[model samples]
Target chain A: MSVAIVFDREVAERWHLREVGVWMFLGTVVMLFAAFTSAYVVRKSGADWVPVHLPPLLWLNSVVLLASSLTLELGRRPGATARAASTAIAATCGLALLFFAGQVQAWSTLARTGVYLPTNPASSFFYILTGVHGAHLIVAFGFLAYLFVRTVRRTDVAGWPYLAGLVSTVWHFLTAVWIYLLLMLRLA
Target chain B: MSHSDSFIRKYIFSTDHKIIGIQYILTGLAMALVGGTLAGLIRLQLGWPGLQWPLLGKLMPVGMPSGVMTPEFYMALVTMHGTIMVFFFMSFVLVSGFGNYVVPLQIGARDMAFPLLNMLSYWIGLLGAIVILLSFFVQGGAAAAGWTAYPPLSAVASAMPGSALGQTLWLLAMALFIASFTMSGLNIVATVLSLRAPGMSMMRMPLTVWSYFISAIMGLLAFPPLTAAAIMLLFDRHFDTSFFLPSGLIVAGKLLPNHGGSPLLWQHLFWFLGHPEVYVLILPALGIALDMLPVFSRKPVFGYRLSVYCLMIVAVLSMIVWGHHMFVSGMSPFSGEYFSISTMLITVPMTIIGVNMLGSLWGARITLATPMLFALGIIALFGVGGFGGLFLGNATADMQLHDTYFVVGHFHLMIGGVTLLGTFAGIYYWFPKMFGRQMSEALGKAHFWLTFLPFFTVFFMQHFVGLQGAPRRYYAFTTYEYLNRTHGQNVVISLVAFLLMAGQLVFALNFIWSLVAGRASERNPWHATTLEWETSSPPPHGNFVEIPTVHRWAYEYSVAGEALDYTPQTVPARQVAVTA
Candidate 1:
């Protein structure tokens, strides 16, 4: 089942179709979240839906997420040394940690407000949507942490940047989703 | 593209498309066994309404009381069987299996666009299949709200009997399945677009790749809606959200404490994904038939562009006509008319495809090989099935035939007929390329005709019975007087079903036997112009020794002054003139 064939590096380099493929894949994910958010708006406008109050901790979490996105963007700068990249990566990691902690605090705030998951549909959606989005962000953070370790160990920056860029895109997406969730809560 | 492979790298967890295709085929075969066994039990229960079957009674105690099938259990079987056959068997085997194996080889690429992602996609789909099967073991049995999993029934645990842990697992499995499809669709689209050999333009690529590429696009666009629907359903079930559950939804005299959700919204979302899904299930088969017809007929495809455009037209039209499924669900009469017109208009593309196929076969040296037999059978069955669409596509006719065995017959003829027959055509046509051995033509033809005749008998009779007022999804017909008139017809249909089931055994036997004892195939058995046949049979890990530089179209059979009717794609232009 083996063949002796050689690929021309020049030919392979001429068409970086993998980049286009990755973009398409990422675009699909964006559209999925977009559809979900649209449904959120339509469903929220209906009567008999009791809109729960937003947890104050979510505001802090949103700021933390925004800061994490900034740190990730800075880490990708051209002249950043290994140490400088790691420093920015560490900031992203720290902010992500704070964001997770803030999410937990927000859940507790809802609990203290007598808005348990099973108590009402509104609380349930609040927990489920945010919880799912947070879980995805956690996975993104794990990828970033891996990149941070590799960068600190002086791995080639070229190889790591694409992965870092993907993680940053997902992180930015999550930050936007959180803002949308907050708006939905406030309007409700 | 070239690689020296160790045994482990070549076979086990191999990145090779051929190996991956075999893995998918074997997995699909296993799932088909499970799905077919379930169908057998369902048919048995239907045939004998209350007869006690020993193992079945033990396995499905709630659904089968001393072998008597309950409605909930019937629904569960229907749902699981449809889910397994469609997603696990048909789509998996046709698109993932054949598409993975052939698309790159046919277009002279070394491998898929992203090999690692392709591997992950298959494993994720395998995991999803496992999760779906696991739902059966859970308490309250598998989801019984139909494969459509329409909400209110699917959303409320108290509404349907199987809406407990089983429903939860069903949603989880579906979400995972959508993720798997998304990954696979990305790979297919990327591979076809970026990996074609030099001189192989988009139009020059084989129709099989085109069909797969279009199907992947449709899946990418459509599956996310279903994923959203699944997530929303999950929230409704576990999180007590009213996404698909409306207020004042009373069940068992208790009003569900939910509000502001429209179940119709779920239907719209589900069918937006669902209708294109039918094409996703069938397009590969259509592509297979198109590829096979020219080879077996010793002619180029007639109106190749027209055929490709027909597939695109069908793909686009399939997205809009899903509302026809909701005609009887209390949609506005005007909406029904709109859906009906769009649905009927799809026939134009289908008719164009049929005419192109016939034109390809016109005045050509036809080889009635087993593969050609199956391809011809598809053309005939697709015609029969397409005509039946006219009955259901008319709003007034659909009003009379909706939810009846007529709809069942129509789909079985369309989906099952095209998918199964077309897939077999692909398997038989490509067997030599995939396995390096020719299948027994006698056994293959036997399998084809036997399967084909019984399929028509069973489904064709169903249309008549449906027109006589027999509804679908019923476990028993012993009591309904109108249905009682059709008992004899049911018996005959059951016999045909039994024969159809048995015919598959011949195919399995032929397929298995060929791998071990059949005649070894030539390097280019069919003298096909496709780049796939340029390589050795059972194509190497990297697919080709030297990636083929395509100089002509795929269908250059019987060109003027050619000594042979066909020429292999790898034949150099200089050699061809000398040989001729």
Candidate 2:
């Protein structure tokens, strides 16, 4: 029998099964965050809802986040060669760390503006919404950092796709949620 | 060495699915004792107002001083009892216990897709149970807000006495508990989809697996909304967020600083998860009933495809009908109409399922074994519960009956009645398979009859009290003329509840006694043809030593030309032909 058939029938069974489960879990998390963002918008439009000012640092954080996504993508490229791929992975982790620092700075800036979490309902929501999202991002970043370490150590590229796909998808989703929250803060 | 040999490592603390199943059963049994005792106290307090029962009075010194139940303590008992039984006992016992042990074995898999995660799921769930129980001793006592934990009442510390640290712990425990369930759901779905042996097609797979698979999918989709709701409520309490608290709200004549949040928002998120949660609790029992009815009837389940289709329909419809719970919440009029129509539409598929179950029992060799009796009881109780839905499905009727004991009766019959009865059926049916010993038929039948009579007596009367304007979740009612009329009925119901609580001891005694003392059984004592029956009793760690290649569907009993009534799945196609 051909190698493809042999592998497909034998080794692929357990691997494919695991992939389906992991993807389903990742998809569920994505949907959960998506629904929360939608609820945030709907609730933001209610009467007496006060809007908080968006921090400028968020724009810088967004850029760092988008760049991290791109770097992670580049690291996954087939023809990029090993050294370049490892460098891209390390850079992605660095930018992710910067993104986290930027978020903390943004919170500090908002606090200085007298927008403490317990000051007003608007401020309280701003902290909770972003804080929860940031906490999730921190978790995702930890997973990505682990992947980066493994990539630098020359772990098999085959396993990378699952984690890589999940991390990128979640990163993109977080970015989209931030944009939605930003618009709601500024306009709605 | 014989495959039946076992070491301590192979039994207790074992990663083996069978052992894990026994662990859940034993733990659930222990929790049931606490739950049952609480139920007895609740009934005693309700049966004779101000009656000083010694032990119960001593347990709740502040709430039931000399056995006079304070409303707070009564609420606490009801709240904890409901929470413990539904989450810890029913969900764990019916789904995690039975589903974990049987799903893989019946589908011909060695173990779950992720055995390590599977074990962790059980441990995390156990940890969650401990956390929840610990809330009883917390500063403010256990969470006394109704299990739904409606906002403002549940959000503000001044709202209720128990809305303080205890409620916070309850929220944390629930969040952790959902995480554990999510892990288990992922495992069940993955194992069912990917691990069936070579010839066991999805169609050939047993109904229990299908129900569990669908229930897992429901849990995956439904639980996160509740988690989100719980987190928002926590923020409202601890961090002064107004997510569920409206502006200009006055609590206890103190102008609450919280503003601009809609309480309806919390309801929307909660019911979104709550309605599907009913199915998550009931579907496994329904699956158990489906599996047992066929075996006892000695026939393939009537309309197997239709039954599966009904389960899918119910799962999807469950998501939409959540809005019905919001009917009285003063949501938008349009939303009420949408929820009302969707809620009624669920009955279409539910009817189909009921008909298929009744049809499965028609014109068959009905063996009135203990499991079969409970299975029949599930059909009857589920029918009563389902029929009662008509009163609540209509917006007009719901306006009258919402939050009434009628709704309580409806749910009790559906969930507590059908689900618990079906769980008993499963426990008795699978006892032999799991322990390699047969439970006492005499004790089983006596327990079933005692449980069946009291169950109906308690809940059947509840519907009337509900119709007569008796609100649920009320610890004590002021003596109005109409309310006084229903007091007699309440007394009767409480008496029956006491009996129902006592009847469970028979099950407990039977279970423990049978584990060590009952007669050992042959591998396939039930003479069933399911894949699980083909394996050795208390199956090996990897389940079947040689994977079974199915020649036919699980139910092939009494087929033409077969010498034996049943045909095990592992039997070769040629042997089937030869027997024919």
Best-matching candidate per TM-score: 2
> What C-alpha lDDT, on a 0 to 100 scale, does residue B117 get in candidate 1?
76
User: Per-candidate RMSD vs. true structure?
Assistant: 4.4, 3.1
lDDT of 2 by residue, B1-580 (tens): 1345357666654677777777776777677777777777777666676667777668767667786787777787887888888888887888788888889989999888888777788888888888888988877688888788888878998776678777887888788778878888899899988899888889888888999999989988888878777878888888787888888888878998888887888888877887898898788888888888878898778888888899999999998788788678887778888888888899998888889899998899999999999999999998889899877887878999999989988988997888789789989999989989999999999999989889987988889999999888777655566788887787888888877877888988998899999899899888998888888887766888788888777777777877888888777787774231
Top model by lDDT, which number? Answer: 1
Label model 2 with its docking quality class.
medium
Per-residue C-alpha lDDT of model 2 across residues A85-172, encoded as one tens digit per residue: 6788889889989988998999999989888987666676678778877887888788788877766775644555555555666666
**Candidate 1 per-residue C-alpha lDDT over B1-580 given as tens digits, one digit per residue, 9 for 90 to 100:** 4568788876667777788777777888788888887777767766666777878778767788775677788888988988888888887888788888888898889888888777777778888899989998888889888788888879988777788778888888887778777887888888888888987888887888889999988888888777777878887877777888887889978988777787888888888888889899788888889888989999888888888999999999998899888888898899999999999899999899889989999999999999899999999889999899898988889899998999999998988889989888988988999989999999999999898999988888899999999888887888778688887888778778888899999999999999999899998887788888888998877888887887666777887787888766566676563222
CAPRI tier of model 1: acceptable
Model 2 chain A worst lDDT window (10 residues): A1-10
Clashing pairs in 2: B247-B260
Alpha-carbon shift of residue B277 in model 2 (angstroms): 0.6
lDDT of every model, 2 decimals = 0.82, 0.81
Candidate 1 clashing pairs, residues 3+ apart or interchain: none
Report, in order, each candidate's fnat. 0.49, 0.49
